[model samples]
Structure formats: structure tokens, C-alpha cells
Target: MQSLMRVVRSASALWPFYLAVVLFSSVVAGLGMAAPFIIREATDTIVDTVSYGTPAPTRTIVFLALALFAAEAASAVFSNVSGYLGDVMVARIRQILSTRYYAKLLALPQRYFDNQITGTIIARLDRSIANVTQFIQSFANSFLPMLLQVAAVLAVTTYYYWPLTILLLLLFPLYTWLTALTSRRWQKLERRKNAEIDAANGRFAEVIGQVKVTKSYVAEVRELDSFGTHYGETVALTRPQSRWWHSMDSVRGTAMTAIFLGIYLILFLRTLHGHLTIGEMVMLLQMVTMTRQPVHMMSWIVDSAQRAVAGSRDYFRVMDETVEPTANRELVAAIETTGAPELTVIQHSPLDAREPVIGFEHVTFEYSPGEPVLRDVTFRAREGEKIALVGESGGGKSTVVNLLLGLYPVEQGRLTVCGRDVADLGVEDLRASTGVVFQDSTLFSGTIRDNIAYGKPDATDEEIIEVAQRANAHDFILKFKDGYDTVIGERGVRLSGGQRQRIAVARAMLKDAPILVLDEATSALDTKAERAVQAGLDELMKNRTTIMIAHRLSTIADVDTIITLRDGRIDEVGSPAELASSGGIYSELLRLTASSSAADRARLKAFGFRVRDDEAKDS
Candidate 1:
């Protein structure tokens, strides 16, 4: 009923198969419930013939045997068909649950995805699915069939021997109430036990995933000790929960066995008193035999049902979540505004009137409630403008780029892309207009051609190759075992960092968006790769609004304008040459670097002084 609704709803889509299943169950129940009557008939007929040594009873027994065989065959067919349908239903539920989970995973906020543990997600997917699967296959297949059979047995017993039926009715309620009371505690304990198991699973997953790092740092003993400590806690928590569940089961079973003994005694006494015939006694005995299995099985199934019901509730919670980035459909005003006091500007080129590319109208944003990440930042990147954001480690450069990509919303100012505020443009439209190349080489497992074409799924072979060539990656790609068709391992792990970054650039080149965001794109590359990628970058930036977030100041010496940022505020913005000439923050950073380099050279010079001359060896 809970999270399992999705699986049920999905399974419901195959109602024809399930309806047949229900009908089959009904037939099986009918056959099973009638088996006792047939047994009783056979027993009484044999006993009557034996009492007088009567002849000519063979034909009657044959007819009864034939009827029983027919019922057995029909019931077997019903059972087989029901089983097939059960499998089909389970498969469908698994598929739907898996599909919806994947969709939900993608829809969750990026920040949320980054924070949640990988192991925890995996455990939820595995355990929740098992819960839904058990409910579908076990509950529907076993529980429903047993319930129908129980009803049939009760009816037949009550019709023939009303006294035993009356006894059963009285005793059944007593056990049911007791079982129900104990079951509540069992269910509560089950929830606690499952949570503890998942937590332990998460801890184990973390250790295994980072085992390489743990060993490299020589922290294996520490990790092992931590694991043992947490495992002990998990065991401690689980023991009580397990004890509670097992205690309930034990109590229910003892009470049920006592009740069954009483019923057997009453039936045997009634037979001796002649109040019940031999046939009725046999029938009642057979009914008891048939019903014992279900009663025992029901106790275990009840625990499963409680777990499934809870699991189903949790699964639906995720499916029903609307984490997609969309709000009211109202259009935001697009007027530009002035910057705050901390936002300094000098010799900054405004957005070209003809192009009207990207404009920041005093954008003020904060990752936290009080700490502003980007404070009233204002800038306009015109077409073909290669604007560089240079700042200290915590400066909000990356945040600004994320804002342009519409990954986050601007809190106090409007950001316009091609004259429409980013909020007004919609996420899909904004993404369509931008291509990003980040410092990390985000490559997928695929052939060179496949990876390149990911930027535009429908790109042709020639087109894909052309984009790779443009990004200076085509030559290296040709050296693979199968060239463009070669399968790169997952995340292109087999490739060098530089090669991966070049592939990323090729992907962006294939996209060819009007705006490009290069967040230290060359940082991961070696000097040779950097040189190769620089030429490609120059061409890629041609006629596009470029926003580059750079850490190394020397690399962006010729950047169109260096915006010196400090603590979410812009300290200065000017040409690299101008800023150097001005002796401001940029000049100070350059001087500091120059002094450090001189000291390094001086140290090296002293170390080499005695080693540089052949006269030292001659002396």
C-alpha cells in the first residue's frame, strides 16, 4: 500500500495475466478444500465393505478414485498457470521499480546527489526492491491462495459438524488477538533491525570503495578497528529486534499447538460417542491436516507483509517527489541594474549591442543562508569576448559559471542570456545554448566516436570525426586498437588525464553552443597537452561568449580581462597588462610569485656552484 503502489500499479497493467492467476487460485482452493471429503468417502466405503466382507465394491471405489484424479489434474494445471503468472508479475514489478528509481535518481538535485552516500543509495535500491518483490510474488501467490482455502475449509466443516466449527471460531479469535498484539512489536523491531543493517552496509561500502586510499595512507588497521566497532554496535542493536520477532513467533506457535490439540481431542471424543460418524471424523481430521500448514505459514507471511507495506510506502515517496527545477510559469523582468560597492569595474567591455549575449544584472547569490558566495556581481560577456575570472581559492568563480548554466537560481539579481532572464528561458533552453569544459575529465565508457557524438546524439561519423579534429584529439584517437570504434573503459579510465580532457573538449566542440564555460579546462593536462589544447581553445572561443574560471594567474596572462576576486567580492577587474602596470592586488600576486621563483633559483645556484666546474676535480 505504501511505496509498493508503483509496483502494484505497474503490475496492474498486466491484469489479464493476473486475472487468470486469481481464477486459477480459486480452482486450486476448491480442489484442496474438497480433498478431505473425498478421503472421508473412501474411508467410510472401505470400512462398510470390511464390516460384512461384502463383494462388488470395486466399481464404486474405481469411480471415486477417477473423480479424485480428475480434480488433482485440474488443480495441478491451475497451480502451474498461477506460478507462471506470478513470475511474469514479479518481473514486471522489478522492471517498473528499477526504471522509476533510475528516473528519480536523475531528477534529484545535484547538491543532494553530491552529499548522499553512494553505499546508502545502493542499499535502498536493493532492499526496497526485495521488499516489493516479496510482496508481489509471495503475498499474492501464497497468501491469497491459502486465504481462499481457509474460507472453503471453514464452510465445509461448519456445514457437516457445527460443534467443531463453533469451537474453532471461539479459539481462533483468541489466538488472532494475541498474535496481533505481538505482531505490532515484531513489526516495530523489524524496522529497527533493517535500519541497523542498512547503516552497517553503508559503512562497509565506504571502506571497500576507498580501500586503495586507505591502504595507501597506511590506515588499514584504523579502518579495520572502526569497522569492528560499528559492526559491534549493529549487532547490539539487532539482537533485541531479532529477539522480539522470534519471541512473538514462539508465543504464537505454542498457543496454536495447544488449541489444535484441544480440537483433535474434541473430534475424537465425538466419534467415540457416535455423535460424529467415522466419515465425519475422518473428514474433520483431514481438514485439520490441510489447515495446519497455512496457519503456520501465515505467521511468517504476516511479518513479510508488514515489511513490504513499509517498504512500499518509502518507494512511492521517492517516485512521487517533484525534484525537477521548475517553478511558477510567470516571466521575470529583464531590466539590468548597477553593482554594489565591493563590485569594482575598470576598462571592462560591455555586452555588444548587436550580439546581446550574456549579461549579469547585479547578481547576488549565496550557497548558505548568511554567507554570500557571489555578492552583487555584475558583468556582461559579449559575443567573442574571452572573459576570465581569477580569484583566491574560495572566490565564487565556479559558482558564477554554475549560475550561467542555470544549475542554481540567482537570489537577488536577474541573469539574462540573449536578452531573457535565465529563469524565464527555462532549463532546457539554457542548457541548449551553452557548452562546458570543466577541470575534471568527465568521459564515459565508449568508442572515441561515441564519446564525441554524446554532445549531439544524432551527429554523423564524419561530423564526429571533424569535431574531434577541431579539438586536436583526432590524431590520438586514431591510435586506439579500433580507432573511433574502440571501447574506452568506464569514465575513460584507461586514457591519460590529458587525453581525457582533450576528449572532453571534443565533446564540447561537437555541441558548438553559443556560450562556452571553461573552468580550468587545461588544469588536468600536462604541459604538452596544455599546449595542444590551448590552440583548440583559441578556436573554440572564437565568436562565443566565454567565461573562464582560472586558478593559475600566469596561464591567463593575456586573458581579455582579469577579474581579481577575494572572498565573494571583486577586488579589481582590468586587462592583465593594465592590472600588472597598476601594482594592485594582481601586481602584488605577481611580485610574490616573482620573489618565490628568485629564492628557488638562488637555492639551486648555490647547490650547483661547486658541481659546475672541472677545476674542482683537478684540485
Candidate 2:
């Protein structure tokens, strides 16, 4: 309601439509009362007088009939004006919410997004906010119209007969009390139902997102059956929900029926006493019946309100979430100062960085509060280093990369990029220095050129092609019918794994950041593409400090340094040759790679390559 009112106040200039509503509502009420008067008068002049041997005036009755029609037409015109205003206000609200939602989305830090469900984040615009449009329309048009109609009926009915009007008025408090109690109960259930719906939406989206993996593992039916069970459970809760709603409706209907009969009984008694005309009694009955309609419409009102309230609660849940505060300092200054002692005077977090480049300084991090993922991670890749980070899965290697990029906060130490402390840097400032390519590279539906140039939105065809060539993505891109202009499906489903990886690399290359972190950049690539991309990555790494994460040992053999991470701690650190000779974790990893290479060669022997184990290792 506060949000709806805010929208109304923002569009206060449209209050004229509200005024028109009031004017027309009054016309409706006036006409509504006048029609009964015409009926009573016509009966008196014709039927009753005929029974008593008197005459009727046809002309006056016709004029009053026309007057009633005109009043109704006038009411419709005003209703339409109100509707137009409601639509206009709702349209404004849609624009306003969309702008605010997107702004908040872009402004929030990576941690918030990381913890949130992807489908939830994607669905925020529709789920809780969908009812906002209806709320604006109903609150303005229906709310006032209903209220005014009730008031008009009370006043008009009282003028004709105060006793009955007072009796009718007395029931309103009782009715409202029951509605309030019932609404309180149903709204709680509605809130729970909506929350569960969001949870289900998130879970369902997660399952579908990995449908390919599920298919490979043959878990498709099991996943779908689980979704079905969740749906059934969600439906089970609605039974109690419906019971409360029907209970309210039953109470309201029973009370109204008893009240209606009682009102008529009084009228019949009064008529028998010669205190009221038959026509007058009939008119009063019609008024009572008309009053029941809005009362009957109570269910609609409560249901709409309940849904709207639920939506508001959900939207506010996200909107009310707090983000990490950026400290008041220049982030780059703190980072540069650590390496160049003379430069350390100020401090800044990621939100306030001077460059997109990132640095890690004895930074340790953990997803859980006490279980550290990376321990005292200290590495510096000068601007443009072709760095590789290779370790077993969950070896804290990715954690180091994430911390260096400021995706996760350094729990025990500091991370600086472009010489500024990431903790104090502004988010945009931190982002300006780097582009990340993940093992599961993501691409959206767009032309190949657009996806490649996503990192640098203004990149020209020449620059995009150059980056693509460097990433070894140009040939595959040309395979599409439109080549650079061909649109890819969602997440680049039209492309193979190698193609996607290359494009992701090209994106990072085109971003042309001064620092690079390769977190399994070539995990899914063929050897041909891997070698080509390796060359590109080496060129990108030149003059830059890099931290790389590679799973395939052959990929990182020539890297500057290979640090073996065991659990959350470093187990070995040296060049691949040095570590291999030490007979440590790196040595084991290199031996495993050699074995795999031999197996690949034997598998390819049918092609008549006749490749030996040593020859394969050299290749």
C-alpha cells in the first residue's frame, strides 16, 4: 500500500481522473435512488390508483426513465476516465519498478548475487511485482468507487427510512470485523504459499539448467519426479487455504441472508400497520439487494488484496536486503603501496579502484565462517602475465582466483588491484580492470560478434576479429551461416564446448585488462584449440602478472610457477620441472599426465600415427 501510494503521489497530476470518478459515482447514486422513485411513483399513479379508481401520468414517468438512463451513461463515462488514469499510473509504476530493479541488480556486490538463486534473481521482476499493476488500478478505481457507493447507499437509504438504514449500518462493523480476522489468517497462508512457490521456482530452474548433465547421468526422470512431489506438497497446503476462504464466505453469506430476511420482516409488519406503501417497501428491498453485491464481491477483493500483499512482501524481501558498505578511501592506493612502500598513504576498496587490474596479498578466504578455502594466498602477476593455476578440484586454487578478482572478501588478509585495496574499492572501479573466463563459460543469445565484444561494448569489427583470431575462435565463428553476425542460442547452445571456451577467451582478451586469472580456461577444449588458445593466452600474459588454475598437468608445464594446493593449504611450489624432479604432488601430477597422453596415443594408433610414449610427451 505504501508503494502504491508512492506511485499515486508521484503521479499526483492524474488526480483529476479520481475527481471524475467521484463526480460520476455521485451521478450513479443519484440515478440509482431516482429509479426507485420512478418505479414507486409509476405504481402509485397506475396500478395502485387503478385499484382505487384513479389515473396515471405516462409522460412524467417517461421523462424520469430517460433521466435514469442519462445518469447511468454519465457514470460509465466517469468510470472509463478512472480506468484510463489507472492504466496510466500502472504504466508509470512498471517503468519505475523496472528501473529500480535493474539499478539495484547492477549496483549489488558479487557476493549478494552469488548467494542468491539465479532463477530468483532472474524472476524478481515478475513474481512479487506482477500484482503491482493490478494494485494501482484497483486501489484507485475500485477502492474509491466501492467506498463511495456504500456511503451513498447509507445516506440515501437513511433519508427514506432511518430505522432500517441504521440497522443496515450496524451490520457493517460486524462484517468488517469478520473480514479482518479472516484476511489475517488467509494472508499468512498466502505468504507461505508464495514463499514456497519461489523456492520451487528456484529449485526447478536449477534442475533444468543442468538438464544436460542430468541426462548424461540418467537422472532425468528422478529429477522430474522430485519436482512433481514438490508441486504436490505445495498444492497440499492450499487445501487449508481454501478452507479459510470458504469459511469467511460462508459466515458472511449466512449473516447477510439472516439480515436480509429480518429487514423484510420489519417492512412487511410496517406495511400491515399502514405505515409504508407497497412500492416503497419494494424499493427498500431492491436497495438491500444492491448493497449485497459489494458484500458478495468481498471474496474477489480479499483474494486480489492477498495476492498483492504477498507480492509486496516478496519484492520488499529483496529490496530490503543490505549490501556491503564501501569504505571511504581510494582502493588502488592501498594495493600499490604494499608493493611500492613509498606509495602507501590512502586506502580504498574494490568500489574505489583506479584500474581494473587486481592483486592478492597474503589473502586467505573461506566460504564457510571458519573453514578456510585458501590459506595465506600471496601472488602477484604483473600486468598481463600468462599465469596458470593447476590443482585438484576444490584445492583452494579457484578460491585464490576469486579473491584476487574481489569476488570473495579476503578473510584473514588484504587483496589489492591496481595498487588499491579491494576492500575499499568501488565495484565498478574494480570491474574496469579485468574480464573473467570460467571453466563453464556462459554466453547469452546474441550474434557471435556481440558475444565476443560483450566485454568491450564499443569494440569494432576489426578489434573483435583480432581478439577472436588470438583466441582461435575465428574459424568456428565462420562456421555459422552468418559467421560473425550469426546469433547464438541461450548460453551458446548452438556451439560446442571448445567453441564456447574460445569465445569466452576472446571476450577476456578483447577486454584487454592489465591482469589475467585463468581458472581452467581450456578445460573442455580439444588439443588443437587448446594449443592455439594457449598461444593467445601467452601473448595476453606478456607484461602482465597472472594466476592460472588448470586441471590438465600438460597445460601448465611451461608456466612460470606451479603451486600445488592440498586441501586448503599449499603443498608444493615451484616450476613444473623443479616440482617434477622433487617427486612431490607436482611430480605425481606430471606422471599422471604422461600416462594419460600414452593412453590417448594408443587409442589413436588405429589411425596409423604410430606415436610412442616419449614422442607423445614431447608433442
Candidate 3:
């Protein structure tokens, strides 16, 4: 009930449409009642004329027939108009609900998405919004009119005979009680079915997205079996649920038949004894028959209401999640009063060069309780310094970058970006101060120009071209048939790895942020592609405070400082040359890389790392 009321409140802005529908439906109901009365009066008049041998009142009979036709016509017209209004209301309500849900999704923190499947989240939104909208449309068009009809029928019948009214009224409570008995169990089954459907849809989406992997592994049969199992469970659940619902329906049907039989007997006996006229008996019978529809509709309404309640519950669960914290209101107001834009352009602040551009002081973080990924990790990068983090795959290199970007909060200590503590800085401000190039070079399905200008929407054509040139992507881009206008497929699948990486580089260059983060930017490329992309990276890193995470030690040979991590704790922090001889994690990794293969040795030698022949022989 609370969920239903919440949905009502969510749509309260469109109350005028609701009011119009009610008024129109009331007229329809009133017109529907008029037909029974006209028929009864006409029948009585005809009977009187025949019994007394009077002249047939032909004009009166014709007028009564026309009146009945007019009433039916008006009722049909009003019903259609109300239905149209209900459709319009439903469309407007859907717009409102969908907009709110999307906005909430945007405001939620990244952690909320980390544990959720992309397809499952989309499924939830689709199912919940669809059910809610369906219920609103049903209520406005079907349930409301039916309710008005039932009320009018009962009121008119009561005016003619109180005993019949009592019998008609008694049928409702008994019918409702039986439906209620089945409702709880039916809803339970519905919820289970919904879960199975959501899971199946989620997996289906995942499978489609990773079809290449499935095909490569020849696991299509396995995937099909899994998908089928979910739907099969839903079918299994429906068997018993359908039986329970129909059983209750049969009982309700039997009870309704018995009560109507009693009501019919009473009407017939009264008319026979001369207590009621034939016309009155016919009128009462028609009115009672009119209620059959609304009474039957009660079951459908209950079922729809249960689905709506479940949908709203799911929707509210997402709505109630805590949104990411925002900058202080007072601070925002102060900035607004000064007429400065909410998001300042990324440029160096007026802080002294001595202050760190990025700092993590005694920070600790964990994705789960009692298992820290970064512990007491402290580091800093001063203005115009290029710092590199080197470690094994799970040694918290990416977590450091994540913390600096405010993707996750620092739990034990402070993290500062641009000399302001991250806790006090707005997340948007912190992220806007840096440009990131990840390992995958994530790109959307759009034209090359769109991807390049994604970071700075207002960038001009010349600016985009300049960044592309700087990133060494201009020559290859022009090789395409459409140049910059060429539409790249999803994730830039149409582009080669080198082409995508260079495009990503150009995107970051166009942003022109003061700070840059390169997370294994060239780690996945072949040697030739790595050299090409590394050239772009070198150019992009110029004059910017850069933080790099590199598994390949040679990539950081020229960096001003190298910080090595061992088991989430900083093991060494020094210049590349210093770390090379520090005999710590960084040196060990260098020795390992140097002796991996002749190709690795050649690559490291080209990057100016010393590789003795003895180390190669030792391997």
C-alpha cells in the first residue's frame, strides 16, 4: 500500500489529467445507468397499451428507442475520451519516473556499480518502470471506471429494494476474502519468477557482449543450457502457482453463482406475487447483470496491484541508495556568488611548487572488510614531476590512482589533489584536474571526432586536429575513407589496438589537464605499437604532473621517481637510477624482466636499462 501511494505521489504533478478522467468516467457511468431505466419504462408502456386494448403509442415508443440509442452513443463517446486522457497521463508519468530513475543512477557512487552486473541493473529498471506504468494506465482506464459503475449500480438497486442490495453487497466481501487468501502466495511465486527472469536476462546480455569469448572457447552449449535453466525454473514455479490461483478462482466463481441464483429467485417470486411489476423485475435483473463485470474485474485488479507493489519496492530500493557526497553547500554558494563557474578549467592552482600536486599520506583502503588492498601507503608528486608506480598485478598500483581520483574514499588518512584534501574537495573538481588513459582505451560507438572531443565538448575542429597530430594519430586517421568522420564501432572494434591507444592519447591531450594518470597504457601493445603509443605518451606527459602504473619496468626508466609496492606497502621510493641499485622490489623486477627472454632483454636495452649477459645466462 505504501509503495502504491508513493507511485501516486510521484505522479501528483499531473493531477489535472486525473481530475478530467474522473469527471468524464462519471458521465459515462451515469449514461450507462440511463439505458436500463429507458428500457424498463418503454416495456411497461407497451404492456399497458396491449392489456387495455388502447392505441399503440407509436411516437412514444419511437422516442424511447431513440433516447436509448442516444444514451448508448454518449456513453461510448465519453468512455473513449477518458481512455485517451488516461493514455496521455500514463505517458507523462513514464517520462517523469524514467527521468528520476536515470538521474539517481548518475548520482550514485561508483562502488554501487562495482558489485552489480550491467545487464541486471538495466533489467531492474526496465521491469520496475514497466510494471509501474502499466498499473497507472490500468487504474486510470479500467479500474476507475469499473469502480464507478459498481457504485452506481449498487446505489440504484438499493433505491428499488434494500434486500437485493444487501445480497449484491455481500457478494463483494466474500469474493475479496477468497482473492486475498490466494494473493499472498501468488505474490511470492511472482517474485521468484521475476528473479529468475532477471537473472536470465542479465546472463543473456553478458553472453552477447562476450560472444567472441564464448565462441572462442566453444561454450555455446554451456551458455544455452544455463540460460534455459533459468526460464525452466520459472516455468516450474508457475505450475503450482497457476493451480493455486485457479483453485481459488473456481471457489469464488461457485460462490458468486450461488448468490446470484438466490437473488434471481427472490426477484422472480416478488414479481409473481404482484409485489413487483414485470418491468421493475427486468430493470433490477439488468442492473444486477451489469455488476457481474466489475465484480469479476476485482480479481484482475488485485493481481495487478500485487505486481505493482513488488515493482515499486524494487524501484524504491535503488532510489533510497545513498548518493555520492557533494561539495559543501556553503562553499558552492560562495563560489556561485563570486560568479565563477561550478567546474573550473583544469590548470595549475596558485599553490607553491614545493607543495605536492598529488599526495597520499598514511592512507589505507579495502574493497572488503579486514582485507586491505593498500595499507599505510604514503606518496607524493610535486609540480611538473613524473612519478611511476611499479609492482605486481595485485600490489595496489591501480588502487593508488583510484584513490587520488576520489573514486574511493581514503579511510585511514588524507589524500590531497592540487593541495586540497580530497575529503573537502568536490569529486568532480578532483577528477577534472586529471586526465586518465587506461589499459583498454575504452571508446564508445561514434565518429572519431566524437571520441576525441569527448573530454572537452566545446573543443574546436582545429584543436581536435592539433591533439591528434601531437598524439601521432593524424596520419593514420586520414588513411581512413572518412578521416575523422569515420564511425568507430563499439569500443572502437573497427580500429586496431595502436589506433585506439593513439586516439585515447589524443583525447587526453585535448582535455589539457595539469595532471595525467597512465595506467598500464602501453602494456598490452606489441613492441612496435608500444613504441608508437609511447611516443604519444611522452609528448602528453611533457610539463604535466604525471602518475604512471607500469608492470613493464622499462617504461619508467626516464621517470623522475619510481615507487615500488610489495604486498600493499611501499617498498622503495626513489629515482629510476636509485631504485635500480636499491636492491629492493623494483631492482628484483628489473632483473626478472631482463632475463625473461632475449626479446625482453633487447627491449630493456633499448630503453637504456643495463642488461648484463650473466643475468641472461643465470635464467
Candidate maximizing lDDT: 3
lDDT of 1 by residue, 572-611 (tens): 8888888886766667655444443556435323322111
TM-score of each: 0.86, 0.82, 0.90
Backbone Cα, N, C clashes tallied per candidate: 6, 37, 0
What is the per-residue lDDT of model 3 for residues 69-93, given as tens digits with 9 covering 90 to 100?
9999999999999999999988887
Q: Where does candidate 3 stray beyond 4 Å?
A: 327-354, 597-619
Off by over 4 Å in 1: 1-12, 166-215, 220-232, 327-355, 597-619
lDDT string, candidate 2, 165-191, tens digits: 877775677677778878877878776
| Model 2: worst 10 consecutive residues (lDDT sum) | 332-341
The whole-model lDDT of each prediction reads: 0.72, 0.67, 0.84
lDDT of 3 at 343: 40
Stretches of candidate 2 off by over 4 Å are 1-56, 113-116, 120-125, 135-143, 180-192, 267-283, 326-358, 570-574, 582-584, 595-616
